[model samples]
Target: MRKYSIIFIFIAFVCHFVTGQNKQLLYDFSEIPQSLLINPGTETDFQWYSGVPILSGISLQAGSSGISVNDLFANDGIDFNDKVRDRLINGMSPKDDLSGTYQIELINIGYRGAETDNFYSFGIYNEGDAIGYWFKDYAKLGFEGNADNLNNRFNLSHLKTRGEILNVFHFGVTKEIDNKLTFGVRGKLYSGIIDFTSTKNKGYFVTTEGQNNLLSNTLSADLELKSSGIITLDHVIDGDSSAGDMIKRGFFGGDLGLGVDLGFTYHLNEQTLITGSLLDLGFLYHSTDVLSYTLKGNATVEGVEIILPDAINDPNTDFWQDLVDDVEGLVPFEENRKSYITFRPTKLYGSLRYNFGETVQSKGRLDCDCNLSGGKSNRTKYANGVGGQLYVINRPRGPQAALSAFYQRRFGNIMAVKTTYTIDKYSFSNVGLGLNLQAGPINMYFMADNLLAYRNIAASNYASFQLGINIISWGKN
Candidate 1:
């Protein structure tokens, strides 16, 4: 029975490693919307029409909270039923209700050419999180008269995850040929630490005579128990540990991209001007670590009764190694195994903006803008999604300061108020709703990722924020 359990663990681990490389399939539903956030051209109209020299600004943006994988797995509570456990343990078909959270932060700063109003910008972005967990159950087969029904039951719990703390530094320049055409190119250098952990927990159990009598007989009879049959098996082996120690090694990689923007004002409109740009053409190199394990079980026939042990493997020394080899067929072990995963970041976007009351307004002006964007990866296993943002900007100046009001929508659902105040070279932008607020420079902004602490108040309740800045010295011409 113990050997059988070891074999099962080994197979499960292999399957996990293979499937993780296909993250696009697992995360296909969470793709970023290109129009709303990635493409700068989509929202270019919001920028000042009379371009300022040294268009240097820093913008920092981040989410409100982080989520854990355990939260998702424990959402509905643990199910002991055999059928349900099997479906979860084995790679079942994809389902939508898989719950988790994702958060990202970006900071950018750049310079706009005074002569040609050509611009060069640079920025850094970091994203990370704990996604979710999955649970599965396995049963041992015993011959008739075998008394140890306990050792025959093994429950396996596993977690599927990938996370990275990455810093992407990018340099881009745009050349404006005329009011109608602009060309741009960008180069990015990515460096960061990636940590991936995969774990499997195996527990052995024996059926007790009182409430678990059914489980006892089921295992002793060597019957092919259905999924629900293991619900009452008494737990014997509590084997929980973390595998795949190679995650400590972090690697580096890079990519390149180009973009363009166009603006125009019709002759019919001395008062109206239309503007838009094509944004984002880039790719990222992702380095990942692969970890594997296996669990197996063995059984022997006795008299009319069945006897199962309380423990599955020896706790003293090489038990884990022995168990793994028994199931995996003696493969060579290496401390460092690496694979590179690659994908295009997302596509650029274009938008049109119409300005009103150019004749009536001198310093203060009103503009209405709509932008659309979408992201599709070269890898089909990855997810795809679209997004849009609509906003009205009102610019007015006071004796000591300049003020602008904005309403922006994101992810097709979330909406917020954006306000900016400028005092000379420094501009502060603030966006938020309810308890969360983000405030910072034109190029950089700070935000509290989550306002409502879901579970642990001390850790989850507090507001987490980020800061960013952009510095561009030349490139207007």
Candidate 2:
């Protein structure tokens, strides 16, 4: 029974913190208001814009690496247990991981402020994100128990994971300084719907020589699980405890936190440009309905030491119960309802671009919207542009990076399109598309990523998409 502790730990970590999907398509495509979410400093030409309520911004992404659902459960006559074992040992490593994110806008709107060169944007969105690495040692232990691997030190430090579902209310301002550089800053208020995180775990399990029994087992553990908005929902769906109640808490009653985003766009020359941003520098304080489980003890067991004097063979003998009680006394576990702080996953994005082909002129500063503030003398519009983008997202397994080369084509000022090819941890065949269309005072846009995998999504390790509509009014100065 003592050996079953690992099962609980595995279930807790694996059940949450699946990696979030990459948002490479919408990061720097400044034609739409959603781009402001990634870089608050992004420039906009609209006099004022309001999203179409819930339909204004919608995005969904899902991805998992190292292994997929078909690899282990397919009906190809391969043994399921053997397939998993082989993949764990040969197909994956400690660095391989699974991750993705889900997000949707509840409200969004933006407009030029009273200041001539200032723009203001604000919105509310719900998001869920998670990240976790492959636990190699735990996998080996489950597949090939200690009965065969004697003297092997199975490590517990490999367990690392964090995840959260929350609502973000954000407000930002983008200001143009002179005509060549623009900077923006955004502040975010987070209301946690649910959260769980486990880090700094340390311990090991090993089998050694014993005096009476053939083998002795030892375990040293120092593990902690901090979670909020989970334990209190044990009876969420029963009686009057409905999902609406949870949502109410998520909107204003749950744990709260604050974060900020900083970004800038600079024009090196008339045809050259560069831009960058840092996001999510904040932490959440989980105090409401918080619960922490802790295990900190070391013990070695060498079988049941007590022997029954008479009726040892009786079915009602309490010898085994006594042994179990002794083991629990040595390694004690505790639970507390204490608060904790969890940091937001940070992200960085940067890009460099050059304009070529035919260029369009701008009438005034309000009309000089271009990638990285690059445009003609008044406002230059080019027929074609090429650039490269770099992105880094911090994860429990460490920081992961993606590099992309993109091409943009503009058909007058009414329509524009951008295409990108990216290489990241999940796949090398990632292709993304973005399109923006303006009809008078109305604007619409759509984006999709991982084009190749759409043919057979089940086999693909990544996929994401976004679309939105808004009404805009341009200034004529």
Q: How do the residues 89-162 of candidate 1 rate in per-residue lDDT, one tens digit apiece?
A: 34332111121222233544444445434555555444332222332223122212235545444333322332
| Winning candidate number (TM-score) | 2
Q: How accurate is candidate 2 locally (lDDT)?
A: 0.77
lDDT of each: 0.27, 0.77
lDDT of 2 at 323: 69
TM-scores for the candidates:
0.37, 0.88
- Candidate 1 CA-lDDT value: 0.27
